[model samples]
Target: MVHVGRPRERVGITRRSLFGGVAGVGATALLAACGTSTAPSAPSAGSRSADAGGGPSRVVALSTGHLDHCLALGIVPVGLAVAVSEATDSRGIPDYIKQAFGDRYDLDSIQVVGQRMSPDLEKVAGLKPDLILSNKRADKGLTEKLTGIARTVQTNGGSEQFKADLKIVAEAFGKAADGERLLADYEGRARAWGARRGTPGTFSLVRGKGDQYLYFGTRALASIVGTDAGLTRPAAQQFDEAASRTLSLEQVGLLDADWVFYSFPGNSGDFTEAPLWKKLPAVAEGRAFRVDVDPWFLNASTVAADRVLADMQRFMST
Candidate 1:
């Protein structure tokens, strides 16, 4: 058996420690836009899987989210594509994936195909994959190129449609039963966690973006999880038209709520120097907590969703 190693430990930033003597604050990156696309073409007719006989054994995932979906469905891609903007140090794989699957799979053996948006086709082709997966809808040319290499499948990109996206992947690999079971299990966990809380107050979602702040809407991943747990959102964050809205320093009051779940990229630095940031009720009362960026803002896999739920349970109970 190929030995798997434990994931490297990551420290969650707290407002008090990371922001000096001032009030605490948490942050997150700008929201990624999900483009529109028609449903992906299904696998060959009469075939239950990506291949003719069984299912795809050799797969290539073109994004961290898709990679997580494959792993969640018991499919490990031989190749993976990551974006240059990925915050994890473990090549392009997110830290949450490492923590969740590190003990079960030899992640290091998986080859890096190329950047998430534009993979190195040569490397992908070399993998000899039976199937490829992606969620990007804006680039038809890239999809065409990948399809030429293997049986490529894609989802309508967005965090809000994460469950639907997972269904698409499961269908592509002939694991619809497993996919539905996974969703049911996840929803059960989220609902159970919420039931235990018994009215956890309005939770604010914030992230640091450059010099400003991002207030997440109902459509964001964390927000979705929060909804699953019966958590309330501040009035300003109730809109679902967009994933997030940019907030200048002067508008920091919009982030105030009963609690705050926030994250920022490692390079984005701390955003605690502003007076308005210090004035937020959650910050002053020490309700704001830093979270991992990969699961909070980037990947939308089931592992990421589980991590978000786990983080909520950990921080809210404190």
Candidate 2:
């Protein structure tokens, strides 16, 4: 079953405002918009089953969220779509995936499948993916349409769901052993991170763009980081109704916590220059950390979750 959400409203802003009044757009913004095309087109299709002996030969990754999981299990799809802007490193794709696979992975082989809110159905169809894997919440409609052209699987955005999806992808590619090992390794690392830092610290996850701020729910990176680091989440009415909730600049003061991890919309860092943002205690105290929305939060999958953990460790240690 394919699921769709309300389309995101595009807010027009002047170039000067986007770059924090800098002379040119930042590298983060350029990377974020990279390979992103508004045009829609049908994707190519082909298949290879894991148990059938050799595994899926012609694969297509519809969701960037799952790209790391696929790469960990030695499955490289013919197509991949991810928000590269939020990546910690400029490698664009996850480092482990790139190191293991090399430059043979071509961006042209991958198509821009649209952002978290809006998916380009035409582009997905044009890729003709053999097996489509994505978060159940984000790609419900696209999954259904892709199924007509190829097999499709859905995984929840949660950590447990991410592991399950990895296993399923591994089985599809006949790499169940590798998948198991990868899961074990990931769990081991998480446990180590937790053990070194015993009790977990409090954290608030927010995304800022200009004057607007969106608070991520427990299901987001804040929750993931909190859980992984053995920390507690602050009680703030738990806005579980939406994936994210918008907060005013004044309201941000209410989110007082040990650490703050935030992302910017469309890769613009203009919000950092806003006087109201600078007034936040977290910002004033140097506890505020900025993340790119695409790779950091929205593109989160099993693979990217590891990076999140690493970043959290760095942030917490400091």
Candidate 3:
């Protein structure tokens, strides 16, 4: 059996990357946007089971979140999209993904089919995956092409649906019980964090650099997970439908909140020095906490979700 090898050994930034940090993940590049599209075309349906002489179920996962779900379920996919970003190292697996589920398994053995946004179709098809899993929604156009290659399943966004997606993947492998248990563990951690956190307070998750600032709302991982840990959302980010909001750096006042978790992405080394960035009450009050973009802004698995809670827990302590 192919297993994760030493190439994935824990280390500092392994290579310079062209991609932005997790928070800087281009939706058009990584996981699809959270809200559903009104007109999503249906994908062909089918699943392969390992019967008698048949080989084991071969799964190919696209996007970091889906890959997390599959790996956390203890099912190393035959092929997975590579993660390449300033937030992580060059290894197909990022440090945060490893931190979240490293104790459970090695990540090196998983085959790197290609980059996240547009994987090498030839390599993916060559794997002959019995099940092709992707959790992106914004680019459902790829659904037809993926389905043509193999049975494909995609999940919706929002924290609850993210957990549900993990269960769906588990069920696909007849490991429903395993999936539910993992979700339960995640909830337990969230609840424990909520109990110890100072008190319920408003917070905003900010991501961006230069002129393109954005806020993740109730549907994004950090916002949803922060709420799970007893934090409330700022009025501007509490919208019901969309998961995120884009704003010009000039409109920084809209980010008002008791506290804020911010990621500077590729520019963490040089936090924006704009006047608007300096004016936020949260920033002036010592309530602004800089966060790692990988786990805090990317990877939507139960493991990553728990890491979010942990980040809040650490933030509260400091």
Candidate 4:
């Protein structure tokens, strides 16, 4: 069961469950540094205004996952969707947000929205947001409709896009200085980690259930590690687009990496129990690792990225 510090909020009857039921397993011990026990802080109340710098008036975040970046730069939204579920265990949303706003804000306060699939347009329109912040994966039709009601800004959901997105959001809210500082700090940490590990090692990034898909050779975080962290991808799979391409379990052996840093459905049980996953060379040799999905890949927030780098350092050092 997912453990929450507080009670759940009521919203639409649908009541979507976050990553509940997923066993923390081998990765649990590694995530202690990344998980937040409290909500992150919101931007100062008077700091953000339509006339502050003549920016967009009403702001709505369709991508609730990236909320951490907005909050870090002091950009609060009229609406947000929560991703916490019973499976999350000890990791709550970032403590900065929860401590700042208390219970006044939660995922339900923001109009419920979805990505890739159709979101509740009527409900979103009712919220009457002035601007919408969404990821590239959001449904194109839904974004178009939302634009009719408010201005829309799209962010690429690549690995490095998280840092870039934070800067863009901060600039949109007149917090460019804050965004830059945060990025520099994160980049510095990443560089330090990279310098310590000499001689690149073979690596692969994977996700999903039953059929595992490998991620490599793209501009995302995986590529960042391979290029910046001194890691190398398998010679055969070293294509220009491997980072973005998804592969099947049968192809897992083709990766032939010295280490595998991948994501799994947080709801699944222990990795050792899964027969198909057990067959992986990385997993068998304890070279495979599971990362928190929200912060590592799905969510692109400033705080989340920092947590990701810390986690990566721990994994690499071990």
TM-score of each: 0.81, 0.67, 0.75, 0.66
What residue runs in model 4 are displaced by over 4 Å at the alpha carbon? 1-57, 81-108, 114-117, 135-141, 209-215, 246-248, 266-284
What candidate 2 gets wrong by more than 4 Å, as runs, is: 1-52, 81-108, 111-129, 138-144, 157-160, 209-211, 265-270, 273-280
lDDT of 3 at 117: 62
Give per-residue lDDT, candidate 1, residue 130: 80
TM-score of 3: 0.75
State model 2's lDDT.
0.54
lDDT to native, each model: 0.69, 0.54, 0.64, 0.53
lDDT of 2 by residue, 1-318 (tens): 221111022221111112222213343443232223221111111122323465555455655656656644434465555544434343245443443234323323344566534556576666656676656766457566667767766666654356677777766666676667655655566666677677766777777645566777766644664576577666762556565777775676656677878877553466567677777777889988875454355655555565565556556666
Q: Which candidate achieves the best lDDT against the true structure?
A: 1
- Which residue pairs collide in model 1, if any? 27-207, 27-208, 27-263, 28-207, 28-208, 28-263, 82-116
**Candidate 1: what lDDT?**
0.69
lDDT of 2 at 318: 65
The Cα RMSD in angstroms, rounded to one decimal, for candidate 1 relative to the true structure is 10.4
Write one digit per residue (lDDT tens) for candidate 1, span 265-316. Answer: 6544456657777788888888888887777877676667767876776677
Q: Which lDDT value does model 4 have at 34? A: 29
Q: How much is the lDDT of residue 83 in candidate 1? A: 69
Error of 1 at 209 (Å): 3.2
